[model samples]
Target: MYTLLIADDERAIREGISRSVSWSDIGIGRVLLAANGKEAYDIIMKERPDIVLTDIIMPVYTGIELVEKVKDTMPQVQFIILSGYNDFAYAQKAIQNEVKQYLLKPCDAESIRKSVQKAVSRIRDIEKKEQFIASMKENVEKLFPQAKEQFFRDLVHGSPNTQNIEAYKELFNVHDGPYRMLLFRIDDNDYVKLLTLKSLVERNFGEENVTFCIIINTAVVLLTTLTGFHELSGLVEKTQKQCYANFNIEATVAVSSEGCISNAAQMYKEIRDIIRFEFYLGEGRIITKDDISVFRNDYSLDTGIQTEELSAAIRTGNIDSVKSITNCVFNAYRMKGYDINRIRACGIELFIIVLKHCEDCEINAWIKNITRINECNTASEIKQFILDFAVKLAERTYQSVISSQNRVIEKVIRYVHENLDDENLSLQHIASDILYLNVDYLGKLFKKETGMRFSQYLLKVRMEKAKELIKASSGDIKVYEIANATGFSNNPSYFTQVFKKYTGCVPKEFRETGKQEEKDSGWLPL
Candidate 1:
């Protein structure tokens, strides 16, 4: 919607133009009327109408003077001049003022409507251009941070073109000279704390000198024009202290070796690799490349035996032995003053071993625990984590072993029932020859599970089958056939002896009176 203002000294002219003109049809929502130039100027200042119509000659001030005064401030406001005379001087003055249209006194409604329609169209065009510029600005602001982060990431990853480096530096307004990369490992993922830390760093080191971004849960700070490591270290320390004080966050910062912008990528990688040594350096401390270089000597961490011992202990479900082996490995690392990187590397290797062992035991829960390997800040913490993890692995492994043993026992019982007539279904045949398990272990497991020795259980099973066969045959089947069917080796005399011991009767007598005796003895059918 648009507004229109009509100014003329004549009451009839002002009222006539306001009433006669179909302003609403021409996109003008309101029509403002004024008696003179002074009144019109006041309304223009207050209302800022989109279009204005004023007489060339007016009281107190002329239309020319009104336009000249307000033109500079309200450049978007359109003006149309009205005059009784066709004076070339007034036409020249209106042209100088950039008035949209000029008309004589008896202008028709069609002429007035046409002028307003043109003015409304110009206003809409100007507004559209302004809106487009505003939208572009909003999009640029949103993408600026992402662009800056990408630029730094490319610089560090050795992918940025050196030819365009200066152009990008100018774009981001980075200063020339000594710059260092500081990688801080933040243990918390709270976005609020991350943002708070970022703001504090920016505030301490002027926003232009520092560019920070979160990469893989770690904050990377690019420091420009840093005087020396001393100054950078102090600023990082203060920032760390402030974060702890304000947000209750603990962080460990690693400073890369200082160099010019050209080496920034290498510096970033170096610091990233150095920070992994925090497992030995402890958190809430600043570690620099120089700090760890002194400890980086050719020292071999012979963890082969220790790892094997730990693996063996875990296999046997010995929690105490697993903890002892873990402690010894870490103690040797501490006592020998091994390189932090080597220590971390060995810890990772040990974790992998544990992971593989867990997989062999079919324990899947330990797989997720691998992520915590990087969270340890000291050798003791790493030891403790490994101990706790090994304990869980051992428990699951033990349960798995028990479950496997039970399955074997069940298979053996099934084989015994299926092969009772073979006369070769002894414990040795099942454990050594068929199942290929340790004979002694299988015997103990079978006895412990069934609460009877293997031979005793076998005898009980054979005798029970014999009783079923006797009842099922109803004296039609011979006693020798029953003995052969029940793994008695076709020996009727021996079968009768065992059957008498089991049922307190000979097979023939039992077969003859077994049905009547079953009712008195409360013996249920198999």
Candidate 2:
């Protein structure tokens, strides 16, 4: 909907035009009346109406003067001139003011409506153009982040088009001078916080001087035309302090060696290496290549013994022993004043051992734990990481042992059930001949698993089978046949004695009774 303003010194003419024009039919939802040119100008300035109709001559200000005053700021507003005189001078002045329509003083409602229709058409066209521009701007805003990230990725990988370097600098509005890349590895891996930090940095350093991009998990800041290392360092420090103050996140920043736009890829690589070294340098600190140059000694530590002992304790599920070993190793490094790289190397070795152990035990979901290990930045953090890894490793190992024991026990029980009728199905035969296990150890394991001696279990199995055969036979099979069928050899009397002891009934009596009611009653017949 559009607003229309009518200005005429005559009140009746203004009200007649406003009432008879049917503004809604002409696509004007509002019709504002202004008594004179000055009132109309005030209304236009305040409301910014879509269409204006004014007489060429009025009391406070002339219509030409109003149009001239507001044409620059209200270029989108459409205008129509109503004049008592049809002189060439008035027509020429209306043309100069770019009025959309001109009408004589005695014009009827039809002429005014036609003029408003034309003004509405022009407003619609203007609105459509504005909408298209806004849509294009929105699309560009959405694509900018992705484009920036891709550009940084290509630059860092040394894959950006060499021919387009100057074009890119101009397009991105980056100055051509010495640049430095600062790579930040945030400990929390919070992209939102990283973005906030990026905004803070852009605000501290001018937005034109800095460009922020996130490559994989790290946030990259390219400082354009940075004056000196000290200035870059100061900016980084300010960013860190602000980030902590605002978001409570700790970030470690690694600055690259100075270079120009063409050297961005190489500088990125250098700074990236330093950022990776942050695993040892700890968090919430700014690092540079120069800071690492002093600690460039050939420092090496033999971690074989520590690794062995830690692995042994983990295998044994000894949490205390593992913690002791981990603390000792880290403390020793701390006392010896080992460089961060050496300490990191040791930490990596220890982590690999745990991972290998987990792999050996078929525990493959330790990626999150490994990530924590990689993020550790201090001796205490490293120690805690090792301890936590050891604890989980111990739990998984214990569960693995229990699972293996259950599987072995199930196999043993299945074997016993399948061979219940074999006469030579003793523990020795089952352990050594069939299952490939030591006889004595298998016997002890079976007893521990089933809470009974091997012989007792075998006797119980045989006696149960003898009773089943005897009852199912209905006297068709004799006692001797039952005994032999139940892996009891040729001893009918012995089978009866064993059945009597097990079920409190002789074999013949159990078969004749056709039920074991006396068994539940604890009846023992000699």
Candidate 1 local lDDT, 185-255, one digit each (tens) = 67665667777777777777776666545463436455556648778878888989998899677788888
After superposition, which runs of candidate 2 have C-alpha atoms over 4 Å from their true positions? Answer: 9-12, 34-49, 57-60, 135-149, 159-163, 166-171, 184-213, 217-255, 272-526
Where does candidate 1 stray beyond 4 Å? 84-92, 158-171, 186-209, 220-225, 239-250, 260-263, 279-284, 294-526
Query: Model 2 over residues 391-446: C-alpha lDDT tens digits?
Result: 88887777787777677767877877787767778888878888898989888888
Error of 2 at 146 (Å): 4.9
TM-score of each: 0.52, 0.45
Pick by TM-score: which candidate is best? 1
Pairs of colliding residues, candidate 2: none
Go through the candidates in order and give each one's C-alpha lDDT: 0.78, 0.76
